[model samples]
Target: MEVKKVDFRNKIRHQRIMKNTSAEFTYSFPVIRGIQAGREYYTTMCPLKLVPRLFKFVEDDLPPDLRAQRTLNKQRIPALARYIIDNKESYAFSSLTVSIDGEVHFEPTDSDPIKSKLGVLSIPMESRFLINDGQHRRAAIEEALQECPELADETISVVFFVDAGLNRSQQMFADLNRYAVRTTRSLGILYDHRDPLAQLARTLADTVPVFAGMTEKEKTTISNRSRKLFTLSSIYQATKQLLRKGKNDKISNQEKKLAFEFWKEISNNIPDWNLCKQKKVAAYELRSDYVHAHGIALSALAIAGSALIATYPASWKKNLKAIKALDWSRHNKTIWEGRALIAGRLSKAKTNVTLTSNLLKQTLSIPLDPSEEEIEMHYAAGKK
Candidate 1:
């Protein structure tokens, strides 16, 4: 038998337009496999290097009026790409959903039932493929491939569905994400060890007398009957502020020790915290009666601590005693009303945080900055 050379280019070339639409159009895609649910879908392995070339974020190039998918979140792509590059060994991504704009022909290579069922899924060169889900992953893969070309060989699974046109694609997008649930920030902090702040928060939750067994590890909110006074996320944010640490800042041994000491000293100075720990005061009572037990107050304390440590590093421990003298009761409307509370409702706004921290700093004899002095003047005048 004589072998004939196959012109692969000719086989894959776009077909000429026909005036009468009687011609059967088909695109043959070499797919790893295909699955059938309500509609036939093909699964293929796409190289990371080819991801950018093969998939297009059409939403970026298209005018707003013509766009089908939401605009690309450029800010998110860099972080995801960094994660991919940093954790190349362990990073895993779910399959990306794509829709091809033309009919697909799957050619089976073997007599196996599964192989025969899914044949080689083909996509014509002219057919447009839109990503319904995982556009972010596609963008990240492309960005990661630029820095780590060796990752080019790594394959990501792509699920291909024949395009049912714009309306179906839009429906597919909604259907794909209809059941998605985002992980809560507090749970992320509780479970994540990669973030220094999260790790520090977990450690503080376990080690600090005030936080020990009194930290809500999984949820952001404490239940009415819950003995936990603070949330893990709140502790994370407060400690991050106390240490003057940015989201990406590295924690040194000195910083860790300082944080440990700061929280311990704070726990000692805040009588309610000690009372709650000893069961003399119920966590619920403290939460209900004092601003100090809430996240807003903790964060305010952190701000004050930062100022105190910067201004009076040598005597900061002694100065912490001033916090014990201040009336931290929620009923102190003259002090907390416009600061931590507005109409007796707790506020977490920047202005409120500054006002509360300013009052604490003043109690510690830490001279107010000019801005703080102006705010204090405004507050005093308002009171008058």
Candidate 2:
């Protein structure tokens, strides 16, 4: 049954709703009627309404006329389509940047689990393309947006800073990231250096491109390692902590400078650093020695050797030549170009002990005979 037109201006003589809440009713009114000529009143035609009970059967309740059905169908489709179309823009913009609110909007893709979430909180507040964080997230967002324009409206949340600040960058990064179940490149950008722990990381990053050039993916790799704290971060922290603990000890300025210089000399001389340069030792072996021998022992050895070389260049000339040759093997244009394909694996695994030590021993091994007692003493004294 069609809904008959109702006149808005009709005045009812009386109106009342049923006292029982369960009772439903519709009001009836008169349709407009013609007026009579020569002062005569006219009565309106009867109007009728169907109560709720009349809507029980579908076929009977609906209008019998096909024209009415067609009009309703036309109106419904366009309304539904418009709602869907308008949402497309908002979803598309989510790809633009990680926003300040820490809510990330990621584009939907087949590979991602349906509930994957993105964004960072308490991160730096910069709007620039991330130099150090969220590589995979960025890549996924960029790729998705490129493929689906509708997803460009998505946004990612992040805290960002332009430069490393007051040595707090790395620590701050760690603090914000300690609970992050998933790792991202943004962690690399947060390396700050105030505390001794962070200072070591800063120093290492300064010395090595692997740390400095770290993408978001590398941060994940670094985080999973047990030796992470003992690395650059550990060394720097230990030095800082020792200094702070001794602040009242009336240490001389010259002594302090020499102490730090000594510390750096030891850090740079670690077997792993040598591995990065593809020296006589391999990375893993160096790591093993570092673990077993203690940092202080190796540090003292490095300091002693460096001091000896500085004072008696003639005596250490062969050692200097060996150092130069190793450095040359690492970056020499002629050697790199000629052997890149053959040595690419070795070069990338620059710190691999088995690979690097074997290569070095085969190529340029030198013999050194230190007494076992001296080695033992160094080991005993060097536990840091």
Candidate 3:
């Protein structure tokens, strides 16, 4: 055994053995030991800088059957990296789980019951580490470090488990992901404070008289019998289009005020929406008959509303009032068949959104741009 002082710069991952022995040398971590299904496991904090040096990505080029983790989606790395870089102060990361295949040593601090649970874990340099989960996060961290090297000192928690062979590692990967459930988009909008559009949507749902108590805050889609009429994600997308903003564009105070005033005007003009808000009509009745109750129509209306503001900034509201004259019933399939409905089902496909927006723009007396005109030409040709 080699004798060396504890170093924080070692490029090593960890594992543990249950032998009653002392750790004399090699990569070490002050860890808390725990048990799972009658087996030993250790948890430790790892510095951001050493993370890239150790825990090398299991090459995706390796066959799926031979590897313990999925191939990393390289496209996702940029967005995740941007999230970390943009929200350095408030970002939260969960612990990473890894399996180690080598002998390890554990040294308890002292004799007390609580101290017995705490110890330093040591593993050799020749050991291999396999990620059971969080490969995306690891890749994101490496990418973030390239732009902001000062984050090297920050630490992330990692959970280490011991098992031999690729078979055990593969099983660990499967078990970690077996029960995971993704968060709903509406819930994401509800809890997200980092997204300006999400904040705008949540505030509209809470403060807008017509929307309060009439919006679904948990699910992206509203059920047939649900008392709610609109969804939070729909509000986010509609408001985004209403302001003519891209997915990640920054919004100013002026733009936010415009969004608020526009929605308020829309609320005052739509009798069907207001009727549902007042409980004068069942949600199902309005939803079944109206185009305005669905995301497709809301997005399309916002798209046209954007053009209306640009075309006649002084008279957009007067032009918007013309929507009350235009038929909004699902039964008006003659006009909406190819635009909003495909085979009697509402469709939110890209072409459908543009087509529906074209009709609304014409109703508002706003001219379509060149691209929209091209789409209109294509749709008109398909009619024959």
Q: Judged by TM-score, which candidate is best? A: 3
Worst 10 residues of 2 by lDDT: 47-56
Q: What would the TM-score be for candidate 1 when compared with the true structure?
A: 0.86
- What's the lDDT for residue 33 in model 1? 63
lDDT of 2 at 26: 37
- lDDT-best of 1 and 2: 1
lDDT top scorer: 3
Q: Pick the winner on TM-score between candidates 1 and 2.
A: 1
Candidate 3 residue-wise lDDT, 116-199, digit = tens: 889888777777887888889998999999999988988889999986688888888889899988888899989988777888
User: What is candidate 1's local distance difference test score?
Assistant: 0.82
User: In candidate 1, what are the lDDT values of residues 1-384, reduced to their tens digit?
Assistant: 222233233322223223455443434445656456677777867667667887888777777546557788999999999999988888989998998887666678788986676455656566788999989999999889889999987888888888887888888887888898888778999878677878898999999878899889988888877888889989899999899887757899888888889999998888888888888888888888999988988888888998899998899998888888889989988778988899998898878888999988888888888998898888888877
Per-residue lDDT over 184-258 for candidate 2, one digit per residue giving the tens place of the 0 to 100 score: 322432343223334343544454443333212234333332333224423332344334333123445554554
Assess the local accuracy of residue 325 in candidate 3 as a C-alpha lDDT between 0 and 100: 80
Q: Where in model 2 is the C-alpha error above 4 Å?
A: 1-190, 193-201, 204-230, 245-260, 267-276, 289-384
Clashing pairs in 1: 27-122, 28-122, 29-121, 29-122, 29-123, 106-120, 107-120
lDDT for each candidate structure:
0.82, 0.32, 0.85
